[model samples]
Target: MLVEINLLPKKEPRNLSLLFAIVTFSGMILIGAAFLIWQMNEKKEELANVENQVQLTNEILEAKRTKLADFQSASSVQELEKAIKWAEKQPYNLVYVLQKLTKILPERGFLTEFNLEKDSIINLIIQFDTKSEAAYYLNSLLNYKWIDEAVITKEKAGDWEIINNKTPLSDDQLTDLAKKNFFPRYYAEYEIRLNIAELKQAYKSEMEKSKEGNKGEEEGGDSP
Candidate 1:
């Protein structure tokens, strides 16, 4: 038993301790690398989710814009047409009557007094430079195409001849002075009155009446 114990070599404990320390260091490095890889994967997944949400929001905004554009383009024109139709249905057309009157008035003539009654009769006093002009206006009024009738209610000189009160004058002298135009010459005045019952009636009837009168005259001449 004493000879077996003496054959065993002496053991050094430092080599085993060195081997354990190296193994521990290598294991810690491996664990740190695995944790880093896990963190990187989580970051990539979060980035993908955020990108998807942004794309969805962009699509929704584009759809909303398209809907707004369609509403404006399709509905506005119909609304405008409806408004125009409404305007046509209104009844008070004073503007149109005024336009027609403006066309019928003479070039050099002007109205001195004008009045329209509640019963639709219009009193119009027209002034002209000469009696011939006044007569022409009356003829034109007789030929009017819009009113029922236009008649000359009154005719007179526009300017009155005022004599000096101090001078004694006879009626014949006044008449002579008027004829000789010792005062300013008065322009011709005509009062035209008409009814606005119809837009176009009187002229045609007047033409027919004149034709009938001419026919009667012709027949009388032919009878003997």
Candidate 2:
């Protein structure tokens, strides 16, 4: 009569505190590691972008430098062309001037040095046996149609030793020169200015005449 037999065993209370704590700590660690991985990926992307920008900037700078170099080369060529044109326009003819000088030179005097200067100026060193020859040469230059003014800037006695050394001579020639070096000689340095305006006018007239002559020749040849 007393009590019914219990078939099931009595249930024990389970302690879940330590397991829950371990699960919470492991979940936090996994979340933190995932967040750190995401941050690392973002940093790598930003670094790549910065490197690409730097490369692009360098490429742009190189292109600009190439363009600048090309521009400078073009400018230099243009300047050289302008200088050549200016030179062509200048009314200066060395051959014509030399021919005139040869025609007007004194018979007894010889030119030792001749220099052509800017603004159509001629500097000449002439040696003569007498001072009158130098004076005559200067007067002739002054009276020339092409020469505007002529002046004897310097006059001095010629040195035989200096003049002899100017020419290459053999030993026998040098001995003869030494024997004949007793006579005193004179030299004059002259500066002559050319009439540039008058020369330009003359040159223009000659060019016109030449053109007319050429045209007449062509017309004559074409006539039946």
Candidate 3:
């Protein structure tokens, strides 16, 4: 009996599924690489813009600082204060003016008005017991060192006088010159304007000197 054994050939499964999986994974890697590259470019652009803005801001701030400094230097109050400070340093003596006035006043004369002005002018109104006394006062003021360009503005006769015995003004005839007060007895009233231009000029000059002094101090402080 020759029985032929029937044998079946071993069947091989298809590898299509593994090939599909590999293709999908490779495509996903490529897409991921593209996205990463795009993100890197966007970040670089943003950084550049930020840097530019910072540079512009710095330039604007520096310009404003320069303008403010210029304005402060040109202010009117600054100029006036500078002038006043300089006046304080000057060697002007108001006491000398008072002394000069005292030296020139006549015994029979009294000051009815005294005005000092910023423009370097002194206005004085004198009331005298006699016209001659007023004349003497004018002559004495003219001879004073601090008085210049004296001019009488008005003159009139008055009859008011005060006699003080304590001043030792004992002139005869009026006999009791020190004890007698008289007004309108040949009286003369006059207004005199004197120039004090020198005082004003001196004040201005001193102010300039002070500015120079302050500048020197600031410069010294800045050194080292």
Q: How well does each candidate superpose onto the true structure, as a TM-score? A: 0.35, 0.41, 0.36
* Residues 1-224 of candidate 2: C-alpha lDDT, one tens digit per residue: 79989999899776689889999999999999999999999999999999999999999999999999999999999999997786677677655666666677655456788886766788988877656667777877777677888899999865643565576764345445644764436788999898998776766676799999999999999999
Model 1: per-residue lDDT, tens digit, 90-201?
A: 4323344445444555554556665544334566666543445566666766675455565666766543223423357653454456456644322433333444444425
lDDT of 3 by residue, 51-127 (tens): 99999998999999899888877786788898778656545555456556666666655666666654356677766
Superposed model 3: Cα runs more than 4 Å off: 1-91, 160-179, 182-224
In candidate 1, list every pair of residues with a backbone clash: none
lDDT of 1: 0.60
Ranking by TM-score: 2, 3, 1
Compare candidates 2 and 3 on TM-score and give the better one. Answer: 2
Error of 3 at 5 (Å): 99
State the weakest 10-residue window (summed lDDT) of model 3. Answer: 158-167
Question: What's the TM for model 1?
Answer: 0.35
- What number of clashing residue pairs does each candidate have, in the order they appear? 0, 0, 6
RMSD of 1: 20.4
Q: Under the 3 Å rule for N, CA and C atoms, how many clashes does model 2 have? A: 0
Name the best candidate (by lDDT): 2
